[model samples]
Target: MKQPNKEIRVLATVTDYTRFFGLPAPAHPLLTLIDLSLCRHLPRVLTPVVQQLYTVSLKRDLKGLMHYGHQSYDFSEGLLVFVGPGQVFAVSESLDTSNVSGWMLVFHPDLLLKYPLGKKIASYGFFSYELHESLHLSAKEESVLDSLLLSMKGEYEQPIDAFSQDVLISQLEVLLNYANRFYHRQFLTRRTAEHDLLSRFETLLAAYFTQDEGPSLPTVQFFADALHVSPAYLSDMLRTLTGQNTQQHIHQRLIEKAKQLLLTTNLSINETAFRLGFEYPQYFTRLFKSKTGVTPAAFRVSAN
Candidate 1:
């Protein structure tokens, strides 16, 4: 058996990843589709490492946890996980791959150059989601994605031509769009959990503002860290469920508090802003106006 490397292996290219997985050379330098079943020497574990390229994988019947950041996800179903460039994650030591079957599609960032997909790729927030937040695809969704991956692989294995890049890029966009749709489905199907998370977020925000003393403002990262999720994942979830991202949610909460203080308390606008954790009263005034269509003082006067 091949022993796992002690140090993190930074896979910089598709070829590097293929070699590490004990597979043959990639047919294309910039892109490749790996059938996980073809690998004979599967490692029992991998140390935390960063892959400096995009990777989208679908795994099934794996008996181990995939760790990303501080969370671990069970890889025992037909789930899809995405890792953008510079993501650090690891596989569990007790990896049981006896029934493992999946496909990994890896493409270098350079391959996206000169394409519209390159500009919009970052909008696919799943690439930065935690492992536990991976997409759990239904059978029909899995079939749709599987076909797209196979199509991309077919193009990847063919002889390179002038139109090869365009065809491959187009296929990739389709795959991403379908993944986006499936993620929305997942969010809607898991409504209970999402709603629970939103409640926790609201409670946390309330506590932060109610505290008598602390930093002037709570950051999006603060909430994400408290909830044990990435900021991108938290924002994306809020956007899908509440029609707003984390920052917007925070602002909305802040405005509600500000309005209450303005109407019920004798504190001046500056005092109210300070109580709501704003360091600058003017900044608070601008934000209040933007969110409520009136300056803080104007609102306070109108209320009185």
Candidate 2:
């Protein structure tokens, strides 16, 4: 049987999630805004788990690690993070759930179709960012995000109209745009930290291919685990700090290694493929050409 796609299981619907947290049902079947203030505290300890839909969470006055996609993020201050479907996440019960305050906006993908955001949403890379890599809202930024959330809640509470979905979705798109800008700001402001991550990233990539038990291996999870972070977090941090993501970074390094072997050594394309862990030479050729605009052998000949 074919393997299932990688996604977190949010087995609960909007109503289920809300009701579990002690809130009323969602106004719509596909979307809802949860006010943490309205719900009674989760008095019992809970295990971490992942959800199945799109979640745009705005948290405030909370401290805890939200474990998602193999990494635990220390949540401090007001922040936002998006979790795509199928990514496993656990909320650490280290802090009192009663102390947690904020709004959690959960919406299924179905809620987004028929809108421009549905098509352009994939371009929003912040959606893939890890919890540690969550967006930190400045006092002013928090207010802006808060206002948007309130508007959404207000819309839901109003009697349903044809204009309601359009208006709410529009607000969501606007909120996302602002988030994009803020992420760029985060990239700029967190230069030192980003640079550190970049350095570690480089070392990690180099070691993957260099050690005897080295380059022939290491899955995304292995690298993430070794780095003490989540794959999504590492990738998100790279995207925020650099223009590329973790997967792209890996491919870049792989291509560079192939280029070196092609030009510096007499390794045939097939030899290079096996050395680089490609079971098929044609696959390597295709990936190489896609990234560099030339076949591996062609590049090797040109270098000669």
Candidate 3:
């Protein structure tokens, strides 16, 4: 008997993605803006797909979960989600494609080539955020983003010319900038949640050092996993609220622990370093000096 070959399809281009969505070919080879409302029908559910293009989508009035990063998000309101290349995502089986509204902007990485935005794109951390951490846009924010999407659509719909790519790219940059601004605004406006998360992170970090088991040094991923948030989301939230990212926070906590061991314990420098999770005493000395402007021995001498 012939066995069926089961392999997940990887959509490697905008055309491949559009074909899967039952849409016409894109106006440009490298970019496309899809208006979901125009699609008269969609699959009841979509299988998980790994795509090789960046996707930014604003979904509204959709009923079901969108899974990404081992989590699922219900798209019951105006929500913005960004999926970078090579990420796997799927629509829930209960998805109601009818009454779907909003737009999907997908672009190939090659489209960004030779542009400054290409190099700077990685700094937009929201792209790596988890599904549940999607940006819930206010009505005003939705309108602002919708207008930008429409502008991009209009620019690209015109016949391709020398100015078309540049115009579209400029609009895309503006869209990203606005998203960045709105993410910062979200962090500021959600004060109660932000404070709660910050408290939880601090408690987790403290407990990690106090615990006797596990790795000697804690990683940013440790706190991120403890908080049920993506590393990028955790770092972005901390950066927005505290002017420090996750690794910086971890280092600050580590240094605090090191200082305590150095001053309060009767351990030698090597012992102190080992207790603080450093394999190399010289590395610990280097870091301690860099952070405190004094070597561990010098610090202990001053403290004594």
Candidate 4:
């Protein structure tokens, strides 16, 4: 018989994950920490998949691209990456598990269901789809994360007690919080590259405004795609250095163009709004007033 297609596998429960990787069952029903070296073979996961569990992994010697929504991270550096529920990625055919050296901590969404981490978990921006870049950790930083992992591992091995869940949850939350802080540090430390991105962003916005055609309003995703960064990452980088996210930057540029048109041209309020690519004149009026503290008409009159 011809070989069947390598289908997408949904690793929903803690057991599902270990079984896929040929490991023994986990200590808990909802969580597991797997040593990659223990895997005798790798699963064929050439297509994208959104797992039901959250995985935070630090591994080296990966032989294939990790796809996040069609984009791939080379993983030449920054071995740490977080994948939350509904985020898509796939291990390619070239994936190397023979010499894999790292630990993966996975937990079902239900693990956090009753704890405060459950509510706070969704708020983590790094876990969002748009922020798919892996975090590069310094030696000290790696040690900090590893220590927390060890704590989780210790609690995981112990007999079930009331404190087991509580201790594990606390350690996991701290781990996530540290990762967040390190991501912020990564954003600031790479000032030169980020500055180039900023320049490109400004140039892109300028070109968009100057062009006489394409009347649709500019969106955050539009600029994000042009810059080749995730929407959340782009916003975080911008906010860190410039104090405003992508939407704010777009709005600021829009107001500048509106001011220029109101003073430099003879277009009516409606025409000016349309020229600036606003679908509705009322929205233009509202946004203009919010930014300028006066309506378009009032601004034009006050200018003269």
**RMSD values, in order shown:** 2.6, 5.5, 3.2, 3.2
* Per-candidate local distance difference test: 0.85, 0.74, 0.86, 0.81
Evaluated against the true structure, the overall lDDT of model 4 is: 0.81
The parts of candidate 4 lying over 4 Å away from their true place are 1-6, 40-48, 71-78, 129-132
With candidate 2 superimposed using the best TM-score fit, by how many Å does residue 221's alpha carbon deviate from the native?
5.0
Worst ten in a row by lDDT for model 1? 1-10
Question: What are the runs in model 2 whose C-alpha is more than 4 Å off?
Answer: 1-10, 40-50, 63-76, 87-94, 97-100, 211-214, 217-222
What is the TM-score of candidate 4?
Answer: 0.87
Question: Which runs in model 3 stand beyond 4 Å of their true positions?
Answer: 1-7, 212-215
TM-score of 1: 0.91
lDDT score, candidate 1, position 5: 49
For this target, which candidate reaches the highest TM-score against the unseen true structure?
3
**Tens digits of per-residue lDDT for model 2 on 1-304?**
2222344335457775666555678888888888866543545324444556788887766665555555556666777877776667665656445566788888888778888788898877666665677787788888888898888788889988889888888888888888888877887788898788779878988877774321453466767777766676677667777778787888888888788778777767888888888877899899999999999978888888
| Ten-residue stretch with the least lDDT total in model 4 | 1-10
* Pairwise lDDT winner, candidates 1 and 4: 1
lDDT of 3 by residue, 1-304 (tens): 2211233569999999999877879999999999988763765435578899999999888876666645677888878988898888776666677888899999999999988999999999988888778897999999999999988988989999988888998999999999999999999999999989999998998887885432477788878988999899999999999999999998888889889888888989888888878788899899889999999999999999
Q: How accurate is candidate 2 locally (lDDT)?
A: 0.74
* Candidate 4, position 285, lDDT: 100
Write down the worst ten-residue block by lDDT for model 2. Answer: 1-10
